[model samples]
Target: MDNILMKNEKFLEKQRTYTYTGYNLTIHPHKTPEVYIDFFEFILKEKFFLSTGFRTYHLALHDLNYLDVNNKLTGLYGSLVRYENLLPSQFIDLNTGKTPEDLKLNIASNIKYKPTFFHFIFFPENHKIIFELENERSTISYNVVLQFFKKILDSDKFKVKFTSGEVHTLTSFKRVNSILKNKKLKHIEFLVSRPNPDIFGDLVDETISEYLEDQKAKNMTLTLTAQDGKYLDLNDNTEKLGVAAAENGEVKAVIENSNNRTEEISTKKFPLNHPQIFGKSVTIRNRLLMAAEKLLPKNKISR
Candidate 1:
């Protein structure tokens, strides 16, 4: 028999351990190894970790070409991979014999199974007005939703009216609520059957501008459900909305026919966890990077 060594002893000895999110990950050939072998070994380790611990590991691919390689690795184990500037791609177990595209479709189907809820909170004095909008038919754009709310806020019909022996409309919310304190009317309800309807189109922009300027009502919380059914607090100053989850599932905003009309766009059930604002489509991937940046420490993240 011939003495044949498949593994390099020096390379194996040089394995380096790195800490990410309190997890210790060991990388083989600490310095640098053949790209194929390095990625293969990394995938194997990730598989082992996931099976035993069931935690997601973040792997940063410095080169764009590695995306193709990562796609290939999906054959070994099917885990969700959120690549840079790419759609949320998936890799599945080899036994399933399913392609990444198939996994994507499966994910899309799962997203459609559940309804999404957008929760908003407005604080007026000691009272907190909570509004939860449900969408079961189609996705609605955040701008359009904001516009809808703006229309309601600016509408005289929805405004606080004093009918006690006199018909008077109060400009200040605080004053109106004070007079109607005993009425216990805090929430205003509206029905939105369509996105960016012609009814509230006029008051959309103006109300958003006024609402943004109002210091008293500035303390508002906006939360949107993610594709995973977990609510992501989008009101974070850094995580402003470009595209977000809607009642039905997730909704995107896009310009229609180069016209000023903005439309709410939804595709089957593909929920965009993080979407960036592009020309007419919300297909860009910068939003995911921004989200990762906010979640991970500054020193731990790389470009």
Candidate 2:
């Protein structure tokens, strides 16, 4: 694999320089012991989970701007590849009416490896990749999985192209200091869910603060919204938390936290709607949308 990768270094370098308008890549199965380069592409493109199928898997491609709310590109700047497995239960003995424990043992004995969730984020413009794994078994290393996809790219099987004639590469996170000369103010709001919003809000605020400080992003402002609808403004202390009417006519709490007391803050009724909240985590998605909104021009609104 290393030799194959080294042989394609020049080709990979050339491919990385070009901004891709779109991409088409092949995916190999996780259970396969050997890399089956000739596998049908349709198998890789199928949904991760199926009701009647013996195998379950998911495959999707998302825009960078959509995944990373802070990104300001309309073109395809990055891609996220997520793959997970659904348990194999077809081998279970249904006719014999085995007990749950028996079935469990049977399934365990039949299974060769533990299932894992693999997430790969590729920033083609910067030639950067972020890989994450969840519930991974000790039997498999992340590099082994990564190598499978890397091999596909190294083989020149995965192809990409730039849509625009003029190409500009954004500052890569790996080399932020050399590329990012201009300092831009970023306002980010985080909404915490119920079951002790105050504590969670504080933790989120501290996390954002530490992140900004570590990244040397001094121009950013962090805001926290609790489950009760009250917001804590980390920037200007004068702002107060207020009550606002949501689109559904329900009352929602708005910003204002000062000196660890809520009484000193003033209240107001404002109707605001944000349509870009996404992701599985409510807290994270709201934060991303709020951060993106803050980066927008003052005159522009999400609603």
Best by TM-score: 2
Residue-by-residue lDDT tens digits, candidate 2, 1-303: 998997776445422111111111222112221121212221244312222122443323322333444542211122234334434353455777653343433443223233333333332222223333221222223334334443334332233211111111111211221111112212223221111111123333345335544664432322534344333333322111100001101122322333443322111121121223223333433333343333222211111
Model 1 steric clash pairs: 78-91, 78-92, 78-93, 135-247
Each model's TM-score?
A: 0.16, 0.22
Model 1 TM-score, 2 decimals: 0.16
Error of 1 at 47 (Å): 9.6
Q: Write the per-residue lDDT of candidate 1 for residues 1-303, one digit (tens) a residue.
A: 122343443334432211111100111112222332343343334331111111232212112122135453211111122121223343556776664554443243113222233322211111111222222222333323333323333434323321111011101222212212212222211111111111122343234324433543321333232343222222222111111112111222222223534333332122112222222222113222232233222111011
Model 1: how far residue 121 lies from native, Å: 33
Please list the C-alpha lDDT of all candidates, in the order they appear.
0.24, 0.27
Error of 2 at 262 (Å): 66
Q: After superposition on all CA atoms, how large is the RMSD of candidate 1?
A: 25.2
